[model samples]
Target: MSKSGYFVSFEGIDGSGKSTQARLLADHLRAMGRDVVLTREPGGSPGAEDIRKLVLEGDTDRWSPETELLLFTAARRDHLERTVNPALAAGQVVICDRFADSTRLYQGLARADLRGLVDQLHDLVIGQDPDLTVLIDMDPKIGLSRALARGDGEDRFESFGGDMQRRLRQGFLELAREFSERFVTIDGNRPVEDVFADMRDVVGARLP
Candidate 1:
């Protein structure tokens, strides 16, 4: 890593196992005696977690997409200020389960017109990108099945339905292409061990 902290984020459609991989990577790096800070958004910080409940819970129609975008951006700003930025300044490796890209795919590309707003908000408020983003690619059918099985009440985004999931998958893939230098697309349909091994390889090669 540089003088600053190394930032890595895991991304994928719901239940694609990016969260699991993020945890595993954090563990692996810690075993290697590296300083690591594992976090997630839009709830990594105290203020953000409160916002998380507002945005993630409630009826699917609780907030319009635009309102939801604003909530996410607000949470992200708090997360960056209270968690990510300080950790990076201290030179620790920060592994996050999701970041701005999730908002881009979920709220932005899900509707064509919203993309411009997402980009503008990102550039204006949340101006940083992860040094590395591990995109776990998987079939929407399988991913949705896994997500539904989790039974977590935080299913507002998941409630967007199958058509939305397919679009999310495509949106994430497009992001990998658009930011190829920072993205590593991993096949998430495989066994957990296989996925972790691939993630380990990518992360190891990039560690300072």
Candidate 2:
């Protein structure tokens, strides 16, 4: 499990621009001659990508929380084994758009109180956390609105509506506090350049 590379994950509500920021950071790192692998949860490796379709592009009631948790955990295990671990072992920076934290909020709190289950599954299977987690914090209403506007067929989570988003936003903040050692919160309501500037500065300070 020990690796020489840096592992960074971006976490936020559906449309908080975490994905965009993650990509930008990856590009910046690569431009600086750093070896970087940019990937996303539930869909990083081939097997995980297949699982992603089953979980992301369906009705809001596609699966029960417990079932969803199992599916996500399965996808993550594959993702970590095939994608993240290999990249880190090769001494490359692994930039993930969203990681275990998303599941902690979406399944653990948003749908029901499953944090304890989430942790148990994570420790039992995943057994890892990112070296740095950049939380793109933003207003839930705005994030959901932007997410729904994407028309990307990944709106199953956004379909839960504003209330769930509000709860998720608060949940993310609490998580930031809970894992303050590696969690860095950056406001996502600002312009792309402004937000990216902060993100770049934060990561640059921590990069090995």
Candidate 3:
């Protein structure tokens, strides 16, 4: 096993600009001559990508909360085994659009009672976490508008509406407080360049 690389995750409600920021960070690091692997979830590796479609498509109620968590955990396990771990072993910086934190917020916050289950499953199957998690915080209304504008086929979550997004935004902010050491909350309402500059500084300072 090798542990010579940096692992970073971008997290936020849908359309929070986290995905874009994640890509920008990867490009910036690569420009500086760093080995970087840019990926996303609920897909990253092949196996995970397959699982992603199952969970991200179809009706929002296609799977029960419990079943959804299982799919997500399985996907994450495969992602770590086939993608993230290998990248780390090869000494490459891994920048993921979303990681376990998304599960924690999306599923856990969906139903207050399921949070414990989410944490337990994570501990059992996905023990690893990103060294740095960049959370792009913004108003739910604005975020949802942006998310809907994208017209991404994966609207299962985006269709949850503004009220749900509000809950998610709050959940993410609370997570930031709980995981202060490894979490950085960036205001996503700002210009993309400003957000990227802040993200670059955050990741650059901690790059290994």
Candidate 4:
């Protein structure tokens, strides 16, 4: 954790329950009397939220991998400036549903092996990362099922089908390895409470 404030980010394939876990952590912290700023990427700030609708609600082919890389990077910059930075600066715990790591895998490797460009853009703009990243690991098939069942218009990524989800899961695992110092893998195949419990434990040990 940084001296300014603890930064925790949750990541996983769609429907892996990462968002739910992030929310649970924030609630737990708040109940404990800690100020928490809970937010999500691609939509944390107003400008980023507007970008989110454009990128997530369109067809799978709505944008190329390069385009997505730019859009997501831009949104992340806005989010950091408007939502994440201030909270951390204020010594508040900032729990984010997703962060630039998502872009590293989703737009970086999963899309077209644009990982090089992804890293460059991230290093250039969004230089910071989560103090701790909780990755809810699960079978891609299971995640895809839950994601499709949601029927949310933001299913642009899920609409790619099971194969893509499997690849995404693999890529995320690889990411956890590459950035092992900050990534914690939690099994998300179990009950929601169980998953949240493990996540909380990991985060509790790390928070200042």
Candidate numbers, best TM-score first, in rank order: 2, 4, 3, 1
Model 1: how far residue 48 lies from native, Å: 0.3
**Tens-digit lDDT track for model 2 on 123-194?**
999999999999999999899989999998988889989999899999999999999999999999999999
Best by lDDT: 2
* Each candidate structure's count of clashing pairs: 1, 0, 0, 0
lDDT of each: 0.91, 0.95, 0.90, 0.91
Runs in model 2 with CA error above 4 Å? none
Best by TM-score: 2
lDDT by residue for model 1 over 1-208, one digit each (tens)?
Answer: 2348899999999989999999999899999999999999889999999999999887878998899899999999999999999999999999999999999988887844698899999999988899999999999999998897898888887887889899999999999999999999999999999999999999899877
Give the per-residue lDDT of model 4 (tens digit) for 1-208.
2448889999999999888888899899999999999999888999999999989987899999999999999999999989999899899999999898899889988889999999999889988998999999989999989988888778999988988899989999999999999999999999999988888888999998
Candidate 1 clashing pairs? 1-208
Write down the TM-score for model 2. 0.99
Tell me model 4's lDDT, rounded to 2 decimals. 0.91
Question: lDDT at 203 for candidate 1?
Answer: 87
Q: Distance (Å) between predicted and true CA of 60, model 1?
A: 1.4
The parts of candidate 1 lying over 4 Å away from their true place are 1-3
